[model samples]
Target: MSPLFPALRTADEKEALRFGEHALSYAELAGAAGALAGRLAGAGRVAVWATPTLETAVGVVAALLAGVPAVPLNPKTGERELAHILADSAPSAVLAAPGDLLPPALAALTRIDVVATAGAADLSAAEPDAAEPDDTESPALIVYTSGTTGPPKGAVLPRRAISGTLDALAEVWAWTPDDVLVHALPLFHVHGLILGVLGPLRRGGSVRHLGRFSVEGVARELTAGATMLFGVPTMYHRIAEALDTDRELAKALAGARLLVSGSAALPVHDHRRIAAATGRTVIERYGMTETLMNTSVRVDGEPRPGTVGVPLPDVELRLADESDGIGEIQVRGPNLFSGYLNRPDATAAAFTEDGWFRTGDMASLDADGYVRIVGRKATDLIKSGGYKIGAGEIENALLDHPGVREAAVTGEPDADLGERIVAWVVPADPQSPPTPEELAGHVAAQLSPHKRPRTVRFLEALPRNDMGKIMKRALGNGNG
Candidate 1:
């Protein structure tokens, strides 16, 4: 089989990764990861303390080099979630940085400390010739899903899925080794660990990770030669808010080659704000843990503010039959996970009879094949009195109001309307919150009258996960 990262052998000693004060070159990374891979060659599976650090990157790379399935555990995960993952994956050993404080959940597991070996003159000289695992179908990583309804299921991703997704993105983004990617996303999720980190490595490019996300940090990296910036909606929202007052931030962002957003939908208001300030449209993409990536806006294509452009090369996408042209996105592609680990029944239900993985995300495809994701099927799809309304459209409408700073919409049981739309809003000013009637009229004016909020609840902030995705279930349960 061809190597996943050929640059590890061919590329010159250019910088490969930068996290905070630490940096590693291709040669140095190979030496460090190769040395660690030799020790992990026969491990059943390894768990990585996925902190946004160079050690975490090196640890995952080492596991990949040895063809061992690596389960990346979120450093900030609660004790319960962390314990669940540990029991579920049953990793033989845990990989962590030196002198790191491990939680009690990982106390019983065998620990392997990942250390910096960049200064070692012959770090790769005496590396053992470990036999590579020949099967591409073998699990490379077992990523856990967010347990919204139940315990997080482990998605068993194969080596080919990662390779296929990265290659397809390379084509769409015009990605090259000369590019430098920058982001401050967490390291456990697919968006951060796989794309933000590994995507650059696959192309022989470098990555500069902001240990913590800040508008100042973004400007610093971009000013220092970073070409691409990756962030979620919250991060972009901050950027949009700061561009007006920070001249250096605006100038630095305007010079960037590409700006990308994912994990959650970027509001059209923020999109327009960033474009007006930076002259760069933020590209959006859609994917999940089960599917590494299905669609993305091409570098060569027009940047539509609200659309997550065409299906990637070799990915087959089709909406389930719907009269309104919006339905659950079902996809068939090489960039798909093998199955949910140890959950045959659940895995069997995730796919259709014809073998397409049901994405559970509601989206519409334009005539030109642009995919505009409406929302999730279970939470964001509202069946009103007689019409099926997507909560995203109404939320977007709510976001357009100057008084609204953040918004999340969900449907609740109502006898009169069958299901009434409820808007959870974080007002722009606490002293003068937008009245329910005024916000309702605002949404009614923007969209149809039926899409207006029947009930409006004001909050200081929306409850969000680590990735900045609103936890709608919390709102549904009256916790927000």
Candidate 2:
């Protein structure tokens, strides 16, 4: 097999990466990462402090060049969560940018400060101690999941999983080296690091990170020749809100080749608004930590407003335990992670006897085979009055209401109904918020009466994780 980053081996002096003001050519990046790879020889596994910077990118690339599995640590992680992650994925060393004041949890490990322009050797020649380039099955990364229910478990991703997902995306999105992608997503998650950073590198393309997401930053990069844009629902929502007043933002978006939203379902309201303003339909894709990517709305196909398009080239996907169409999404594909690190029992339980990995996300396929994600089986699926309801649809319906700015849907215990639908809303006009009756009627009219929320609670904002997914479990009685 060819090397993971063919561009790095070339004498191409073209700009390969840019983070804020820092830039690196393919030759410069190759030299820096190669020198670091040589230093990382014999390392079992290294933990990278994932900040949104060039150093973080170089560090992970160096680890990959050395064929050592790199575990990325979220910079904003709390002390408790950080301690738990360290204990769970015990690494021999930690990689971070120079002068970063690391937390106490990382003090026990050896620190390797990553420098962007310190090396002088190209990475075309393999280090004597590094693993062979064809070792596709070797563990390349150990990413930890958000432990919403329990402690976070490490998902062991192999070299092939990274390459396979990127290549499939390149085909479906018509991605090429000419495409210069832009985004301000965090580096720890798959959407940000693997897709945002590694995706461009694998395609021999360029990526310009915003360092921090802002309407101005997005406009600056896209107007400056970035061909593609990546973002979560929250970032897009802000763009949708600003489009009417920000002509530059709208113009920039209209000029781009593609606008992709992932990590959470983009509200149909925002999707429609952006498209109407800029004439660019924002496409959506579906994937999780365990599976890097499964399905996407193909560039060649019609842009379905709500569906996540069809399965990628080699992925086999099916619905399990169907009821009225919606069911748990299960997939088997080369892009899947090997297993949960150190948890053989959990790994075994995560898949079916037939080897299809259970994604736990609930979705239904359209007549033409497009995938529409409903919600997760654990929290978003609500059984109300004998009907299995997906909260995502209801949430989207609520978002369409002019009075509602933000929304989350969940289920609560009820004596009459097995589970009653509850809507947690942040009002567009808090002073004179729409009555619960109005919101309920709006949802019922859009969908069915049974799907309407039996209880409507108002809040300033719905709780969200770093990736911008609404934390439905956090919406309890007192909070709203």
lDDT of 2 by residue, 326-406 (tens): 999999989999999999999999999999999999999999999999999989999989999999999999999999999
Pull out the clashing pairs in model 2.
Answer: none
Q: State every prediction's TM-score relative to the real structure.
A: 0.98, 0.97
- lDDT score, candidate 2: 0.90
- What's the CA error at residue 313 for candidate 2, in Å? 0.6
* Distance from true location, Cα of 197 in model 2, Å: 0.2
- How accurate locally is residue 186 in candidate 1, as Cα lDDT from 0 to 100? 92
Clashes within 3 Å, all models in order: 0, 0
Looking at model 1, residue 139 earns an lDDT score of 88
Give the Å error, residue 165, model 1: 0.3
lDDT for model 1 comes to 0.90
lDDT of 1 by residue, 1-480 (tens): 117777887535899999988898888888788778888988999999999999999899888888899999988889898998999899999999999999988989899999755666256442434545667787889999998879999999999899999999999999999999999999999999999999999999999999999999999999999999999999999999999899999999999999999998999999999999988899999899999999999999999988998999999999996657788999999999999988999999999999999989998889999998889999998888877899988999999999999999999888888788999999999999989999999999999899999999999999999999998988864433
Candidate 1 versus truth, CA RMSD in Å, comes to: 1.5
